[model samples]
Target: MCKKVFILFAIFSFLLFSVVMGNWQVAPSSAEYEYSAGDSFTVALTLNGDGNDIDALGFDLTYPGSLLNFRRAYFEGTLLDSWMFKQTQLLSEGVLRIAGFTISGAINSGTAGKLINLVFEVKATASDEGYIFPNSFTDDLAGATGDTAIFRVKPLGYSVIGYIWYFSNHLPVPNVSISLANYLNTTSTSGEFSFDLIPEGDYVIKPEKINDIGGSVSPFDASYILRYAVGLTQLSPSQLIAGDVSGNGSVSPFDASYILQYSVGLIESFPVSRDWFFLPSEFPLDDANWNSAPDSISLSPLDSDTSGLDFKGIVMGDVTGNWNGGLKKQTAAFVSYRIEAPHQLSQTKIEIPLKLNFNQATLAWLVKVRYQAVGSKFLSAEVLGKSENCIFVSHEKNGIINLAFASPEPLGNQQIMVSLYFEKENSLSDKFPKIEICKARLNETLAQIINLRENDEFQASSFQLLQNYPNPFNPETLIEFSLKKQGYTTLQIYNTAGQLIKTLISGPMDAGNHQSLWDGRDEIGNLVASGIYFYKLKSAEFHLVKKMLLVR
Candidate 1:
């Protein structure tokens, strides 16, 4: 009997305490708001409960005078499906009333949930002097008998005001977009993106539209140096793995190089090995780095800076090299093209000559030709006549043509040469028949740029080592050869015993027809009795020796 009495007393005391002090209290007790006269904002009504079931609710509210004009009331996924009474109306000129209740029985909104969303616009003349906006929400009064068995509710709200701005180069960025939860906004010309009304919930904001998408391995300014350090990259290890341009199992340096090559149309396959982590299936390599981890000011490595400043955007400070940043050119080569519509007819034939100046033997070469494609132009490129040294030639899409050449033997620098010929992309009666070699790669690096405008009078067809005019001469003779493009060129005269007699020409020469008069003398300028002599012309991919008679 004594134990039962003690338990009963304890229960009674707990119930009395529960009835005396409600378990919930509206949070953030107070807040303030300020905005421009034309700005509109939302006020979110929040309900926090003490882990109790709330079947129904009733609330009354009063607001500041003429400061805010109620626009709309909206809520989704709420506990109350039916409203017995709901409204926002002016009780008096400066005071507004909001009253609402739930119809059906017990609903549990434990801890927190949005009870209501109200949009309000400040009057054109509204000022920050008094900005006391929304009313204190109150809920407690019940039905006729006052049944408090279900839920004790608490209300909370916050003041929404000024927005955030995104700027670059000391100017506001316009049309940049960002969103949080259910709120979305676009930046104005002033670079300000605003969300006037929003629920106070845990939110993850997403940003977009700052710069053109571009490379990985971003070149860092002073700020990003810390952000992209080896172990401290702003990018996660996963993101760094995505920076692996070749998908070679690590975020290697080659990724940056591959990005730049892809941008310029040097490689057909994107990233050459498609395994990017972020939105891989959606974006291309054109402006790829913009997808993540670049830009100096943002300081956020996870978010990408889609601008032209990305490391992958550009590379090779001084040399022409492949994505490995290897295969740099010590010197440049030149190229030129000739197009002729014979007799002013569409029977156009195009030719391009090449000049390569290098010390090492060229292993391989790749060139891309872009043309103003006309009817049958694609057909013309594939079937165009080329030299026997060319191993492969094919037409790629979009008026691009790929030509490649490789030699089993080491073709010395001064022995490298190439020529291309095809019917012009234009048809019969076409005014401008156009095609140009846009890019070239030797040993997989961009061929250094050099001008090969040797002969403006006539375009060349191929590398030609023309016979010496007046071969049997007393004093001198002229040796001629067609310089298709710029390259290391050399001319030598030899005796019948194969000993060098004189070196006539040894230097870089532009594309065109070149001629040199070789006097009948040795390197020492000594004239001797001559029998049979040979003159040799050597340039990139071209080597020829012609027999000549010298009578002295």
Candidate 2:
């Protein structure tokens, strides 16, 4: 019985040792590769053993026929290197059959490595994911099959996505041109841009745009720039670049003047060569040398999808950074003030004073006036009581006039801001020329003019020459007067002998309140003896004289 048990054990051991276990697979169980159409790639077929040898192997390698084409297989340094017979053939559209055997003997159970290398050429545009799988592993000597190998080919390219925004408001900027490699795309309404099918390589992305240089460029921009130049305020790097309208590398009053000129339509274009400039969103805000920084984004050896590569747009003359990428929708506010000039067509000339009734002080104002009457033509305009530190500009196009004024300090109310003069032509029609205020702003805020007062009827009776104060006993006196019309006027002092003593005023004067000072002097700047003096005010339509006693 013991001998029988020993024989059975020996038989069992021989049978177990003779069993051949084979595991066939591709070298890389699963892989992903990128390739453009018409490109070529390779994969290896490999085998792993469970201490069992296989003399022959056969399998079918399947792939997407539309994306890949089968090429020659290589076995120079694989397990099938010394095989006596090796065969490979295309069984169908995308199915490849590979078979090999060695007549020398079965391959050593421990000898396991790559068997063959399968080559394929990309036939067309690849899908998102393409697979090359090995199936039906059968051999002349075999055991249990092992895990299958799957080779996945991904489309050969990455995506680049980004956005463009306005530097001031962070609003999306549309219609901007974005470039990567040799491809170009325009931004959508949402200010988003994207580029696809980009191969693996270093690339530079650039943005470009052409816009109106004068958009959103107003007197406020000039004021802001002036403040920055004088160290009264701060400016960002981009603002500094925009304030340099002359392209002179620095901000100055000259640039402010140029910008103001452009805003008022004095100049058609800015001195800067480019209307818009773009910078990467990641650009440093503290970079004082922003002008020297690269205006493009660089991707070195880009291999995957990249997004959020945003940019900021800067308009050249918009120092206040109010440009909305030329996409702004503006609605004028209600009228805050009105000046009425009710004159018959019989009058040859008319003057309209823009007087505000509000008591609020303002630092800036912009008024747009429309004179649409066919019988009247605008002659000229002037600002009354204008401060020395203030900047004022007026532009006239067709029958419209734009008046922009900015002051470093707030101007008091109840003052005449501007006076418009017009010349009326003789016409038989009784229609009065319409002088309307189309728009008005007070320091960037809309103001309303509730009443339109007719000054023509009240103007003639309003002229007056007031009595001098502290008269009869002073070396100096103040004389006040009011004019109903704008014309060449004169104020003179004379002695009782009727000889002219001194002329205090002699020039074209606006129709408003005026004052003059007489220091008891003669025409040659000599002090006169204490005596009686006559002061006279004369204009085109009015004349008056008053007497005062000068005492020493």
Candidate 3:
């Protein structure tokens, strides 16, 4: 009876001690992993002791047999480094058994650390699921003797995705270079980019692209920068970089001046060395050193599949953010205007006045003039009258003239804005010079140029009446005609039914080209309804009629 009681008491003590010790578990460094086929990787086996000392530990690890090739096991820099006995074996095609024990002393209580490292190489592609699992765990620790510990291993791949866009319009910028470590990718036409099979770690991403810096820089951009300098507006971080055309690390009115000069071709390049700049979409605008921050992006400790790593692209002088990779669309249609030069076939030098006929006020304008005739030299140009308040710049090169002007205050209407002087070679006396306005801007909208001629193409002996400008009129239109000799002229507007509505001119005129403005009205000044109408020019030697339309 005493032997029976002793054995039962010992068994009870062992069961109580086991209940107090709890279970010991071994797990991988990460619960999940990502790798492509033919890529090599490492997995660390860590020991987690539940306040229990361990002298020996062993486990059977199972992996995807067909997809992974087992390399070798490492035990350096681990809790079992001083173990007297350590062994690792490939028990089966996909099963590895590893064990280690220290005979020198106990591994110590509450010791939790890495036990071994398992190396592997992916052989084939497979669906995402459990790739490595602890099939069995055993340890020579008191109390946790037959308890099963849960173990899991997942292998989900990782990717980095992002987009690039224009800072001004938020339009996609394609073909931009995006880099991650040693990997590189170019954005698609949709401005989307991605890098697959990336490992989990810290990285810095960068973007780069270079393009012709023409047509994207304009006076509007300078105006935007000026507004920002005066605290009248705000600009994004990327926009600030674009506004720093002088490369002085800050934006100022002087930068605006430089940008304006570049827009008008007064300066061939910006003081900034680059034609384009970029910033991460997630860049902190409120950072104290944001103005001096690097252009690249940082992904500190990227540990998962990351996305939405977008970037903003800026043209160096496009502070208003209106660059669309040189494919900008017009905001408004072109409105045609004419500038007539004085008929001078006898002089070798002449001054042409650039008079604009408009009732509305203008804040900015840019005009590009091209001289079609050879040997005609443009001497100088100057702003006159109210236009003198504007910042004006003009550059003439290779028979092309670029004029850019901006005013803080509105320029009044119906005035001569500039005067251009030119000298012609006497050898080309018989051939008339033709001046064409290649491009023109009034405010922010594009304007059309019509009838940029010295005089009418007809002979001096013939009387002529030209068609009215903007034949489909609104509330006004211009009537132009030429007289072979001085005489009394009557220009009358009549209804389509041949009844006279109003007489625009009834007086003696000189023998030259003439123009008259016809407001859409009757003789009493009442606005007429929308319809087709005719105008007749009757003189002693010329009689002609033309049709026009007016829409209210």
Candidate 4:
């Protein structure tokens, strides 16, 4: 019901926007040409928009009827190809009205598309300022069930300016020779050059300098390409700036040096996916966004180039430019954790493996862990390795724990970010630490995360017994527990009626975490029946009992 209401509200909002804001638009904004009287041209009208659904539309267009003649309307490739009701009639000498609809119930959507082609014949000489105006338009259907959005009426007018510029040193290249159809001129000091007062025609402009080989204009190749040129040390001022090697705007000796490295095969070029951009690290900027156009390529020291996940589940660092904090960003999608054998009813230490998909050096990060336990008390946590000093108390609530840790410096040079260690005290039998990410700021505000396994490594903090892994033993199973002090311990199994079934251990045990094995057999070497059973650990001062299952 709520979903239905939300959908209704959405439809209502769309209708409101269409009725109030009117987002429909027309494209090409402007065009230009010099035509003699009687010359005719075709102007394709494209319906531009922000993708609102609409079935019917009507608009009033005002043009200079004396200067141009509007031929019969064409809808060969328009949304109104099968208009239920179509009208294209002149309301007055200079005003034309248009109305169209889709009886098949199609709606206009997407960026924009051709709606119609207007064939205009120059009736007589007309000023270049003549235009087509979407004076007013009504966007609606028969009822309010449809959607409409705010739209801007775009006007197409005549244009007559033509120019292009080349840039250098973050400024326009001045005095550069440019030519078109044997017409020649040098750019102004401001780096701008243009053609003006010319009759209407399409033209291509070219910039030229003394003969120089042209190759891919990429930073990764510029250095080598320039190095292989005839004169290694001397290039024309134009050639020097043309390389734009560093892309810092001006030509510099460093550009030549970079080329030499590439030419010698000392460095290689690579490509990155287009959907990435870089901003300063001082403030956390945009989220992960990628483009396909590709960004500039450059060379870097080989040592800082390793990143991604490794065999041990540790996150490798992103050494590339911190695109979306790739260097420090963690891939939350593949992120997961594992638990080693715990201390068995004692203090357990959880190892949080930090994994990554990329890294160049040590990646710095901060993580807030929120964890809760049913049979354990939340205890202190340690930031593994050199990053241990970065841990600080953040927050805590109920039985859950939150810990914050940051690196004093970037950590990926060694390839793996440090691991995290968490301790839980007085945990119940077989209870593993339950942890989650409250917050993770990789590279300050850019990064991924660590995976925490359900069963993790732990150190026994008190005398306690833990449930056995692979229980319901067929042949045998291991029962692990812990002791705080050295003592004589007895481990016995019994059936439902409290009858002794088997004794696995009846001797001295070490004062630390330990384990025992149990096979599904009674003292007489007879197979036990498939049923419920209980295991009890008894010492002079401590005793605990837990249930288990047996199968024949």
Candidate 5:
């Protein structure tokens, strides 16, 4: 009887080991398929066990969150009804109807491998598009846990090209990566890449990831691809040599000398000139009409020189205001001057009734004041209610003196007016301390303009081949590096065969550091035969090589 019991115990131990060891394994181990835009692909999941009854195997998969253009999905099986899309919370299998059949559902437990399947509709976006499938199991094992699987749906027929531009004098941010899905192309340190050609369509271009610094990545870095037209054509010299800015067929000095008479006060207009009716000097200078007149000092024509500037307003605005254009002798004579348009204001003047409140404010009594927005196009100011006044002052193209009100504390229900006094050839410091009063209402103005100089200040460098993380990597590891500039770069893996085994990136990189997850797989996704693999980085100016090991 004791011998019989020992044999039964051994049999039970063997069965238990088998169930644990063979608990879960995905079929194909890895899947590879190419799809065009608006196309579909199929993937299967099979079980390996001694009749491990699985009522349901649910999956919660996410694409490269920023990459895939998620549309709809479906699954197959008796548990197809159990598949729920968490975001929309809709049953994926039911709503996904393509062709004569709904391509997604669950399989019957009896059918086993025959029942578990999925269909995905591909989007015609751009190169390097893909999706990841993560799965979970729901079975009679009760307390058992399941592992997830990842599957990729690659795009077909597309090429990817990377663009990189890095300039110094800007913030030196290197190590950036640009990825294109359909072409399966990623940029390295060189900032150059070529992808497989695919169908043309709009691609969502965004900085996939940002540098370690808190600075935001550039959105303008994104771009769309335009496919080739049916055919191409060339233009003749007459058609090509248009726009006679310098006129010779091409317009140049001869045309300008001939048209100089039209300039200045000599003639009303010129024949060759198409648009000049909007000149500022042509109109009687007034603060209200400033936005309409084109001037030499503004950004439109982008004048680098400003010599003689002057403006005489009959009456500046809703408030009684005046100025003599020059900065040395500025003037401000107003109970108040209110800004209009761009936005609206309720006050036009500041009335000083009775004695002024000197406890919390400083008032200035002036003969006159002027406002000007000279050599610039924006108006931003902070006004003071009581103490701490910070105002932006500038000279205007029309010779008006502009004042931007600024203050530290909030001005509630107070309408305060800043008055400036201008006298002939008189400097601001030489003017009288004007007695200014107000009902303290702070109107703050801030403009969001492109600081080209600042924008150009922070330039990214190319992606670099940093030392691989976990250097003597086992079967898995990570590679990291920074791109100090922009341009084409490459990260290639070479086996002992001296042949290129895999390409981690072969494209343009933005300036910043980036990391790639490498599993020591060859180009064919086969576990590279255990040995040594060298990764090389080649860019326009940088060449680096690093060695890594693969242990079986």
Candidate 6:
């Protein structure tokens, strides 16, 4: 009986070995796997046989050329005695060994019929054309089988991509969709996708998504943005101030405005997509009044009483600019007026001592003027009464009305010269009337400010992305570029096959000239192959793609 029992035990041990043996097996899920060029993946590893525990079991991964890359590795077990294992074989310094692995007893230990798993990951080459990389494993113990996983990388090429965070503060949206149309072509999967082969043509990228639910559809965020990947010849001005319809750097507002004119056609640049812009809160300006129209009150240098002439409580009509009065004295007239708070300017008579040539004069009408703030705020007055300029604030304390009735040459129109010396000594003492231009005419005032704008055009000092002096970039390359505004940006590298080979920076950056260096490897420290490569710049609104050659 003793002999028979021993035989059974021996047989059982052999069978267990057989089960765990025979070339370690993988999911076989896809003999070949395709992945996002710039994305990372996590996959599971399985063994065919069942064994409580297998000792002296490990894997050795090798890399042929600087082409393939390795990042990290892990070993799964159920041992209570925690221990960290150092990496024995590494292709390059880039290989990160995740050591010191100790599994809790919750799992089966050696001698049990449980399976153990070893996980690992590797990065792809930095080239456009996909490279076939094979991951092979070798088990020290004879019973376990060796396994390998294959991967194929995709590329993003000249297409630049970005996302818009569009969510309403009021509602809870489970899943949101941000889509793009028009000049920017996009393809999305359940997961991430890549954009490649973009031309230099201008395009409009607007966000379109469903809100709350599919049934409750709404417009995209007002502050939509686009990810741009400019290719080859970088657009002179890295930014498109207004009409960046294509989202690329070019003054293509003409395209956007044209699309607006052709209402019959599909609206390409309208803010309708999610990825095109951020939520409304992302807007940087003051929310004071993006919708309301200000009130406009008419003023005739003729009416001088506070009774019927006191225009208040009425909203202003859009101020219409009148050139009939000549450019020298252009007038913007409003129909309604509202008294901004209640305050009155001191009634006084003002006169001009000196007669001078006139260049420009702006006249406004209002109800009551606060006297507290003189030069800072506007002061109101009645017109045409005993005080030729009664409503007008007279700064001159003594010389209110210097009436010199002498020259008959300019006689028909009483040579009434008004002067006020209040601005010099009491700079901030005088109050200016609050003139709310017609809501419709608000744009006119803003335009006037523009017409008076000083030339502040920016000239980007450099254009071409200067290559790192020495051809085979040793450790790094000093990259330099200039920007007008600070924004989130990304600098990356891609191989000929269009795959994302490396990422130099991925974060919001400030405006002004910038310089970054690439160590010629990918996110993984593995060295890259020598060849023609491309680098791209991405921002909330700027996308530029430039090429570089890496000679191995």
Root-mean-square deviation of every model: 26.2, 23.2, 19.9, 29.3, 31.8, 27.6
Q: How many clashes show up in model 6?
A: 61
Q: How many backbone clashes does every candidate have? A: 26, 6, 2, 57, 109, 61
Structural similarity to truth (TM-score) of each candidate: 0.25, 0.51, 0.41, 0.26, 0.21, 0.22
lDDT of 1 by residue, 1-552 (tens): 999999999999988756533344332223545544556776565556553345444444444445556677665554343555556665665455556665554444344555566666766442223333333434542311111111111112222222222111122334545554566766554445444334334444444543222232233321232334445546433244445556454444465555455556676443424321212112233333533532122212222212221111122111111122121123454323333332332366544443434445666766665556444343432223434654655556666667666756555665334443455545454433244455555774455333244345445567888666555876666666777888999999898888999898999987766666666777654575778899999987889989888888
Q: Best to worst by TM-score, what's the order?
A: 2, 3, 4, 1, 6, 5
What global local distance difference test value does model 1 have?
Answer: 0.48
Worst 10 residues of 6 by lDDT: 310-319
TM-score of structure candidate 2: 0.51
Stretches > 4 Å off in candidate 2: 2-16, 19-139, 144-150, 261-272, 287-294, 325-332, 335-552
Which candidate, 1 or 2, has the higher TM-score? 2
Give the whole-model CA lDDT for all candidates, comma-separated.
Answer: 0.48, 0.73, 0.72, 0.49, 0.38, 0.35
**lDDT for each residue of candidate 2 in 4-61, tens digit (9 for 90 to 100):** 9999999998777566443433444445555667778777766665556667778777
Residue 82 displacement in candidate 4 (angstroms)? 55
lDDT, residue 233, model 2: 96
lDDT of 6 by residue, 304-373 (tens): 2112211011001101111110112233422222222223323332221222211222232121111222
Ranking by lDDT: 2, 3, 4, 1, 5, 6
Name the TM-score of candidate 1.
0.25
Best by TM-score: 2
The true-versus-predicted C-alpha distance at residue 359 of model 3, in Å, is 16
Model 3 over residues 128-237: C-alpha lDDT tens digits? 43457665656664333222222222234468999988876787888888888999999986789999867667899888887645477889988998888889999876
Residue 539 in candidate 6, Cα distance off native in Å = 58
Tens-digit lDDT track of model 4 for 166-268: 2111223344455545567655544355544333444444443321112223344454334535455543333433343444544444555654554566654
What is the lDDT, from 0 to 100, of the residue 402 in candidate 4? 49
Model 1, residue 81: C-alpha shift (Å): 40
Better TM-score candidate (2, 3) = 2
User: What root-mean-square deviation over C-alphas does model 6 reach?
Assistant: 27.6
